[model samples]
Target: MVAIELKIGSFKAEYAGKMNLYLSLLDRFERGENENQSIGIILCADKDHLDVEIALQDINKPIGVAEYQLLLSKEELQTLVVNEIKASTKEEG
Candidate 1:
């Protein structure tokens, strides 16, 4: 069994605490339901590597932290398209 937590902003200590508790609870209640040991994953928009390290140092559970990417904003997409068009035009000329 696996538990995944998504965070919009950044990694924090409290998140680790919550994950620890949740994993512990799952172990207690969902025992024998999952063949393998339960795992937790934290997906955040942005995270500080050091902060995540310190947050999970004391905990005795399996947890992983990773970052996720959001779709580009309208303005950013438009800018990229415009740049591509300009570059193409220059190459053709």
Candidate 2:
């Protein structure tokens, strides 16, 4: 299996913990379930690309790193919340 490593950028350690929440994320990027193994590293803030490069000195594996961003508007947030409640109400009905 090709071992894969994931480096995720986060605002804080709390958010970095979400890395575990996506344990299955790399499965799709993989060529096949038996063809690769995945690993992940959560960075609270990576100021430079070089920083991560240095941090992974001895590790030799197929790796990937990405930054996540969120954008929300007041109306969009409210609409989503209302829609969720409506969906639940329908379930109960």
Candidate 3:
């Protein structure tokens, strides 16, 4: 299971706590007996590496923090699509 949380601004320490709660709930109540532990992903518009490190330092569950662009340029989107196609083709080949 994967739980994703999206934020519009910079990452905050509280976000990590919130994700931890979600992960805990999922793991305790929703996860299957044989399923792998749930993973959490927090996506923010901006993040500081140090802040992320500090926030996640003591976390035992699998969680990832990443920055996301609110809007990508047309060219950027096209490039991403092309790259995705190439990746899929390679996988199929």
Alpha-carbon lDDT of model 1: 0.89
lDDT of 2 by residue, 7-26 (tens): 33433333333443344455
- In the predicted model 3, the residue pairs found to clash are none
Task: Rank by lDDT, highest first.
Answer: 3, 1, 2
User: What lDDT score goes with residue 34 in model 1?
Assistant: 42
User: Residue-wise lDDT of candidate 3 within 1-93, one digit each (tens)?
Assistant: 999999979999999999999999999999999999999999998999999999999999999999988478868979999999999999999
TM-score, candidate number 3: 0.75
Cα displacement (angstroms), candidate 1, residue 57, comes to 0.6
Best by TM-score: 3
* Tens digit per residue, CA lDDT, model 1, 26-86: 8888858646677999999899999999999999899999998879986897999899999
Inter-residue clash pairs, candidate 1: none
Prediction RMSDs, each to the true structure: 10.4, 7.1, 6.9
Model 3 misplaced regions, further than 4 Å = 72-93
